[model samples]
Structure formats: structure tokens, C-alpha cells
Target: MSNTQPLAGHVVVVGGGVSGLAAAHFLLEGGAARVTVLESSGRLGGKLYADEIAGVPVDLGAESILARRPEAVDLARAVGLGDDLEAPATTNAGLWTRGRLRPMPKGGVMGVPGDLGSLAASGVLSAAGLARLPLDHVLPRTKVGEDVAVGAYVAARLGHEVVDRLVDPLLGGVYAGNAYEISLRAAIPQLYEGARGGRSLIETVRESQRKAAAARQDGPVFAGIRGGVGRLPVAVAEACRSAGARIETDAPVRTLRRTPDGWEVAFDHDGTRETLAADAVVLAVPAPAAARLLAAESPGAATELSAVEYASVALVTMAFRRREIAHALPGSGFLVPPVDGRTIKASTFSSQKWHWSGAADSDVYVLRTSIGRHGQEADLAWDDTDLVRLSREDLGEAVGLTAAPVAARVTRWDGGLPQYPVGHLARVTRLREHVAKLPGLEMCGALYEGVGIPACVSSARGAATQVLGTLRRAAEPGAGQ
Candidate 1:
């Protein structure tokens, strides 16, 4: 250990994903003596990517960031990349229901019926379904203390029609997992808060909207970068380096342990065994990876980490000529409700959503089709070619496309997005408490709090704050004693 180092301490951030990178950036900005980022893969930006297709950029992983979340936008602005931000070309996203496309009901928050009148008018639900919704207003609230699955809660309050028609598809698009497995408290806290507030879900959303309007600061609902969403990660990485953070790629952390002084991180760098000493560490990888790394040091945390399940998914990007598609590629994209029983879960009209995606005269269309879900990994077992074919077929059925795509690309993510299973928030809370007992250690990623880009950013930023605070405390005279 280099005792004379400025701030006289080292901080190690494990995992090269967005969360890890963001943490490193913050630590450097906070004036840490040494900040080392260990990434298992040769490249950074774990799942975030921008691939070229027929001379156009397309995001294969996360497509957009919710503008409402200030974390991502703030980080972008801090890195001088705010000018690259762009909102969705169109805000209209439809749901494929009963073999027909129906526009997603407006004013619904993540498929929770915020406005029954809007939901009813959308024709997404039948007369009986609409009538059953208000039953929630009169029905006695269940007094359950345990975390309940979102599927069950929604069905209990709003009937199975809402669950099957809206919740499942919307959640599937986000978590890529079954609604029955997701925790209402963990996944949709606002909805849970609404129920606790003694108001119907519709009333809660209406009130929220009213308050937001009064605030006059509700930002864009969804937005992406001009070049691609991946640019945000790239900018963050650059900022970290500029701020004096040392990032090491191809450095896979094998184990972590608590040391009397601080912490020890063991990793393999190109087949060489190496260990780093740090005053603090942040584990920002996925749940499974975090579980494996923390098993020896914090078995309780490891168990909770392993308990969180993840779903595999693949993105099939296909491009078509301007005149190839029969139906006009109007809105941002469309989602396939599980009721449709289709291979594709959703498709995003990339070209239409972002101006930089294609040429003006070319009318190039980029479609991102998802595969795999809870108990449906086998659906993604098909070869890349077959997946492309199936995606094309599904798109043709949904949007009347007849022409062959000019280019096609496929990216597979095995256990990519974490599923916030029932009691997930409780488990995460317990894990965080356990980790706190181990001095100079932190964890952040899609598993703990949220899975979106903004969520990851928030977690990272929070971790950085903790690290900086600890450093400041330790620097005080006789502080460590």
C-alpha cells in the first residue's frame, strides 16, 4: 500500500457496466487519491452498445432513458453531452391485443390503470372489464404485510383483464420477466403508494399529473441521444478518465474480502493473479455476478443477491428500404402483449424515433424485436438466422411489412435484466444493511434499486457520495481510531 498517496487511499470499483463507470466518475470528481475500475469484459459498457447497420447507428441494449429521471440527464449535462439528447420521435406506443393493435391507454403509469375513463375509451378492455375496474374503489383493501406479486395485486384490484392485457406486456417490455414474479412494491412503488393512500389507482395518477402540471417542470417522458443511447456511457467513461480515474479492462474480479485496514480485491488480469488494496469498493455488477463475488465475505448478502432472478433476452435489429414497409412506420414502436402469443415481445422503430438513425431520402427502418421471458428461454434457442426470420414474420404481421430487410443484426444477453421478484425490495434492504456492516464496501447495479439506465446512474451517484463521505471522515485526525 502507498501510504503517502494523495488522500493516501485507493478505491476499487468492480464491474464495468454503467453503474460502475458512473461510480468511478463520481469518485474521481470527488478527489479520490486512486480510483480503479475493474471490468470483466475486454470492453466497457456491459450491455450498452451502438452497432452499425447499413451505415446507421442502433442501440442493441437499452434504447432510451426516462427524461423524468434527472440522474441520466444530469450526468449527460455534466459530461458536456446534453446537446446530444433527443426525445422520442413519437410518443405513441400501441399494444398488440387479440390479434389487433390497440394504442396503449394514455395516463397509465407502467400499465397501472391511472385513468379508468381513458383506459375504457381506448377499447383495450371489454365492457365487463371496464365495469370491474371501479370495483377497486368499493372493495375493501386487503391487509397483507408480505410483499405481493404485481400480477396478483393488479388482478385483485383491477381484474385479470388489466393484468393480462396491460401489466404483463408493459412489464415484460421493461423487465423482460413475468408479471407474476415481479413485486408490486419493488417494481411499481407509486402504485403501492396509491393503494396505501386510500385512493383508486386512477385517482392517484390523476392527482400526480395534476401536481406535475402545477409544477410545470415535468420533463420529456422518454429520450435518447442523437447518435445513440450508448453515447451516454461513452461520455461518462471519458469524464471519469479526465477526472483521474484509472479504468482496467479485461480485469475480472475473482473474490472480495474484508481486511483489517480496509478491503482486498482479487482479480485476474490476462491470466496473471493480482490483488488490489482499497479503502472502499463498489460492486456494481449484476446479481449473479455480485453473489458469486461476495459469497465468501458476506454470505447473507450473497444469498439475497442470488435470490434475485434474471431473464435472458435478445435484440434482433433489421433494416428495410424506404418503400419496403406497407404500413407507415409512424409511432416510436409497438409492444406485443403476451396474449398475442408471438415470438417478439416488442419492436422499436429506431429510424423513426431518432433522426440520426437513417438517411432522409432512404426511409430506412430499424426494428428491435425482443425474445425470451420467464420460463421462455427456449424461445431464444433458435439460431440468429431463424430469430431474424421469426422477427421479420412477426413484424410483417404487426405492421404489414413485405420487403426483405437490407441488413439484420442480433445480440444475445443471457440473464441480462434482473427480475424484481416478490419481496425483492425487502431482500435488497436486508442486503444493503448487511453490506453496511462491512466497512468501505458498497454495491450498486440493476439488482438493488432499479434496472433502468437512470436507476443505475442514481445508484452509482449514491455510492460515490458514500465513498467521498467516508474518505473525508477518515482524513480527520484520529478518525480511524
Candidate 2:
């Protein structure tokens, strides 16, 4: 170890996804001696994967990152992807409800209506739903103790119609879980903070928009790499390797145990069992995988992790001859509310939304639709052909799009998104308490913080910071004595 790089000894990062790779990067910057990333799968990026359709690159996993949050975009720039970052060509999304695709009403926090006229204009809400909406202003404050499901609180203040047609689909897009079961505090803290004061939600969201707009924010709300956001993790991993981090793939970690000075990680490599000692460990896998690794060392934390649930989803990406559907597809895409009994939860017109995907082939158009959510994996069980057929059926109804695709690809993310039911924050807090009991240890991923790309990177950075702090403190004079 170099004297200048004085943080600590070797650190093994379990999980080669973006989180783990980014953790390694941060640890290296924070002066960790070495970071060995172990990934169970052959691929490194976890949910950030890519495949081409019609010879044009497309993200098979998450397509974009929330640019409003700096973590993900900053990470991209740090890893030499600064020039590749591109904002969506169009953000004119819609809500597929009431048998028509209407413009998604703007200036609301997660589909909570702020402007009644615009929402009413969109026709996303029926006449009955519209009538039931204003009741929120006159109704008594719905008490939210500690935490409450977003749908429950929204339905109470507004109405089930607002939740069913609007909030459900939007929350489904973010969480892949039922809105009625998602934790308000963990999911949307703005509303939770207001709920603490018993203020009307309409006023809360309205003021939030007002403040946001007044702030003169100049950038796009979201961003993606020119080719595909999937390239992000690949770039990050390369950066990690350049910084002296060793990344291992298809090497599944079998166990994690405490050591006198640090920790021991056991795993398989080339059909051979291998062990590595580390001064610290960063566990960045999903809840279940993390639970399994920590089961022996931290049973309480493992048990709590085991209780966290996940949702499965599949994306059907397709390409078509542009002339066949030119001028037919408009806006970015639309979100589907499960209440409408739609097979697909949401659709993004890739060619129309991203300039790179659109400019790739002038004659060909590309798009994708997502299927399945929490407790809704039955649709995902269908094979690629069946899944594509059903998704096309929904698309046909959605935008009258019936052009035969030149190529189609289905990407299924099984147990991908972690669910945040009511009390999720509390559960996470308790689990962290358990993890905190074990020094030289920390946890991060979509499970601890928000589930977006920025959130994941943010989580990784947080873990790296904690581990670096501990290592540096231990390196202090006579610290252990």
C-alpha cells in the first residue's frame, strides 16, 4: 500500500453491478488499497444491459437516469461518458386511461392532480373522478401516523379514482408495486412531509411545482447515454479497472463471515472454491442476495432482508419501417394504469424519445412496452413470442400502431425492483441498525435508498464513504489499542 493512499487495506465488493462497480471506484478514490468485485453472473451491469435491434443499440434494462438527481449523471461524467449523456428528445408522455391516451397532466407530484383544469382537460379522470377530486380540499385532514401507503392517503384525500387512474400507474412505473401498498414516506417524502403537518395534498403538490418551476431549473428532468444508458455500467467497470480494482464475473459469493481484523469472503471461481480476506466489505446486491451472504454473520439483518419483496417486469423492444408508422406515434409514450385492465404498464417510443435511437436509422422506428408488476408476474411467464404478441395488442389499442416490426427483443427482469410497502423506511432503519452493529460493514443498493439509477449510485457512494471513514479512523494512532 502506498503512503499517500492511506485509507485502509483490501476491500472486496460483492456484486459487480453498477452499485458494486461504483463502490469500487469510490473506494479507490477514497484510498482503499484494493477492491475485488465478485459477480455471480457473467455480465457485470446487473439491470443495465444492452442489445441491438435492427442494428441500432437499445437498453434492454433501464433506459434512462433521473438527471434532476446528480449522482448518476455525475458518475457517468467521471467515467468518461460525459459527452454521451443526452436528454430525451420529447417528454410529452400520456396516461392510458378512460379508453383513450390523454396527455399526462403536468405540474403534479407523481400524478397527484395540481391543476384541475389541465387534468380535466386530459380526460385521464372521468367525470365522476373529476367530481370526487375537489372533495380533497373540503375533506378533513387524513392523519398519517409514521407512514402510510401512497394510494391509501391519496385515495382518502382525493379519491380511489385519482389513485386508480393516475397514481397507480405512475407509482407502478417507479416501484412496480401496488400504489395502495407503497410507503408514502419512503417513496415520496414531499407528500409524507406535508402529511406530517396535515396539509391538503393538492396544495402540497401545487406548491412543490410552483417552487420547482420558479427555481428556473434549466436542464432536462432525465438523461441517457447516446447509444444506450446500459453502456453506463460498462464504462464504470472499465474506470474501476483502470483505477486498480480487480473485477470478477461468474464468481458467485457463497458466504461472508467476520474475521479478527476484517472479513472473509468465500466464492467459486472456475469451478474452484476461493477465499479472500478483506479489511472491509461492501454488500451491494439485492435484498435476497445480500441476506444470503450475511446470513451467518448477521442473522437478524439477513432475516429482515429476506422479508423484503421484489417485482418482476419484462420489456418488449421492437423496430418498424418508419414510413409504415410515420407521423402516427406522438410524444414520448404513455403510462398504463392497472385499473384499466391493460396488459402493459407503460410504453416508450424509443425512436421518438431519444435522438440517438431515432437518428440511427431514418427509415426505421423503435419502441418498447413494459409488462408485469408486483403480484403481476403471470404475464411474464409467457414466452417471448406470446409476450410480444400481447404487448403488440396493447400497442395497437394504444396508438393504432400495427406495423410489423423488423426485429423484436424481449428482456425479462425477474425479481428486479424491490418493493417498498408501508413501513419500508422503518424496516430499512431497523435492518441498518443490525448492520451497524457489525463494524467495518455497510449496505447499499436500490433496497436502502431510492431505486432509480441515481439512487443506486448514491447508495453505493454512501457505503463507500462509510467504509472509508471506518478504515481511516482505524488507521489513526493507536486506534485499535
Candidate 3:
């Protein structure tokens, strides 16, 4: 594999989400002769959509990038959006449990507290629950024979109160999943590593914190585009085009097949059918869609991909007078535990979180509430008007605000998040093993590594690298022999 021009031939990336766009951009950067992106919808960004509400631009889909990881931020800068990257005004988060807002405890891994003093001060846990925490050190070392549920393991050590109140809300915010079912290794890798460490979970977390602090990682953990995260795809698509890549919206891939030279991709555009042959192919769509396209080629991999489940949720963005809010928003947002029995699971004070989201007059306040979760889809059945009403009702109850919203918009994201259940990593490993047998073909997205913006971009880069490696090997003498 000595060839310098590893990706010298045509490559086609299916799906126009951030992952696919990143893949196309990387392929072009890797010296591919040509790259084409096929997006089924009329739009480019799949889940990172941007729209205006009350004359203010707000993200209807993914709004933040976990800036701690360099993938998403680096991709943004590579696409000429470095000047527009903006960090949150505040990163403080709150927990709405026990009919009150409590400061989220610091030094917790997925809500598993590493410091006793912070947990005690936060008052998120009751006296009984707080008393149960010290028992973790005295109790015998809990054996994690294999992968276990995050809730089950944490509850065994720290008690269920922590899992229910702090952990559930945080996990739900990201995955829309139940903590009792989500995988430890896949969802929260740091916590999983700490759990397996020889020391107690608390000690393990404290040690991890010490290491991080010594590294002096000081900055906002998240970043967002000034306009909206939706601008990311547009910028990436532009970069791909500048590098001579073709991006086609309204193009849905129907089938993918292996050819003697490389791959044959079939798709539809504008009510007409067409086919394209490429030296390599990247499938960056959701798991279900990828499964359908791969069914004829590898049934085992397709079955595993089809088994991957998704969660749906809706966001209700509302505009209100800043003075109308009864309670002070000390933090960017507050997370509501499912145990709270509230209609909304979480809410974000967009104006406070990002400066660009705020109104010029400072009288208008913009915020959004999230509804529905992994096992909870009934709430999403309501129409937009009903959703807005329900969101307002919950907001009023939480903060005692009686004023009505001036304008509201409801955005429903069906199958927005992929759930990672126990054994998910194993299934992903098996899927990759099967896929490796098919040269010049690769896949990447939220279903595999993680569901965050950074993870998706990282996965896409990995797929592009794998395709490049395959191309390099094929160009080598006696590669197939």
C-alpha cells in the first residue's frame, strides 16, 4: 500500500447528514478524483436543521457541538466557519427534581458523583439517598463481569436515587434512552472505565478528574455556529463543491451492489431512476436505511443494523417577553427527570445559552422545551398547537409564569436518536467484521460510535480513511492474490 494517491478514483457517499457531508469532504481532501453526495430530502443537513422563529434564527435539530472533541470543531474550521464558531455564554445546568431546581453536582460521571461534598451541597439527593452514597466505599468491590446497564451498575454502588434523578435526565437529554437499558461501555465510556477500575467508583472518578484538571482543559465544552448548527452542512457542502465534489439533493439511494471494478449505486432523482458506478462507496445514513440498502449484499449485517432502534422527540420553541418569566434562569437550562411526571423532559434558554439567539431589543426571550423519549411517543401524537399549549403549561407550572408566548413553533424529529442497548458494542463489532469482508464499501453514523456531533464527524473520517486504505491496498501489486 505505498501509493500516495490512495483515494484517486470516484467515491459516492449516500446520505446528506453531517456524517455524509464530512465523508465527502474528507474523500476530496484525500485526493479522490471525484466525490458525489446523495441526499434523499430536499435539504442538505438531515438532523441539523435551522429555521427562524419570531425573526430569530434557532436550531430545530442539533444545536450544540461537544467542543472538547476536535472532530466537529476542526471540520467547522476546515469548512471556513471558524470565524463564526461561538461558545455558550454559560454551561451551568440544573436538575428539576423533587419539585425544585437543584444545582447539578460537579465531578460526576453521568451523574455518578465523584465528590461527596458537591453532591451533598447540590441537595439533589434526599438525606437517605445521600447517606446511602458513602456505603459505596464500605461495600465490597462490585464485580462487573461483563458489560452491564449504566443504571444497574450505578444503582448497585451509589443507589437508585442518583440514577433516577441525575443520571436519567442527563442520559435522556442526549440519547432519549432509559438509563436502565442503555449500555455502559457505549453510552458513557469514562464511567464504564471507572466502574471497572480497582478502586471504588467514587475514587475512580476523582482520579479521572485529577488527570483532566492537570491537563488544564479549560474552555466551554460545547460550541455552536453563530447562525445555527444547520450552517455546518451548508458550509461542508460548499467545501466539497470547491474541491470538485458533486452534491445532489432530492436524490435517494435505492440499492448498492458490488462490481468488478468497485461499486454500483442505484438511486432516484426527480421521479427518474439512475445508476452510478464508483471506486468506493460510503453509507452514512441511519441504521434502518443502511440496513435496507445492504440487505441483498450481507443479510447478517443487515439484520444487526435493522435491530438498532431509534427514539423520537419534538421541540417546542417559544418567544416570550424577558420580563414575563417569573423565575430567574441561573443556568442555560434545566433537565427534568422522568420521575418528575412532567410533560416536558428538558428545556433550553436559547437566548441565554447563545448570544446570537437573543433578540436585539433584549425584551424577547427565546427558549425551547423537549417532549417525548425512547418509550414515550404518545405526547408527540398531539398537533403543533397542542404541543405548544402543553409546553407552556409545563413551563408555567415549573416556574410560575402566567404570561402567554407571543410566537411558537413545534418541530418534530421522528427517529431522531438511536438507542444503544446492552450488547450494542458487540453487535457493532460483528457488523464491522462482516463489512470488512466487502472491500471498497464502508459505513458510519450515530448508530456505531456515538450520537453527538463530534462522534458523527469522527466516524465519517474513519470511514473515509478505511476506504482510502482499501484503495491503496488494491493498487498494490498482488493485493487480491
Highest TM-score among the candidates is held by which one? 2
Pairing residues by index, what is the TM-score of model 3?
Answer: 0.96
Model 2, span 41-61: residue lDDT tens: 999999999779999989999
Instruction: Please list all clashing residue pairs in model 3, or write none if there are none.
Output: none
lDDT tens digits, residue span 5-33, model 1: 35666999998888998888878777788
Q: Give the TM-score of candidate 2.
A: 0.98
In each prediction, how many residue pairs overlap at the backbone (N, C-alpha, C within less than 3 A)? 1, 0, 0
TM-score, per-candidate, Cα-based = 0.95, 0.98, 0.96
Error of 1 at 136 (Å): 2.5
The most accurate candidate by lDDT is 2
Ranking of all candidate structures by their lDDT, best first: 2, 3, 1
RMSD of 1: 2.7
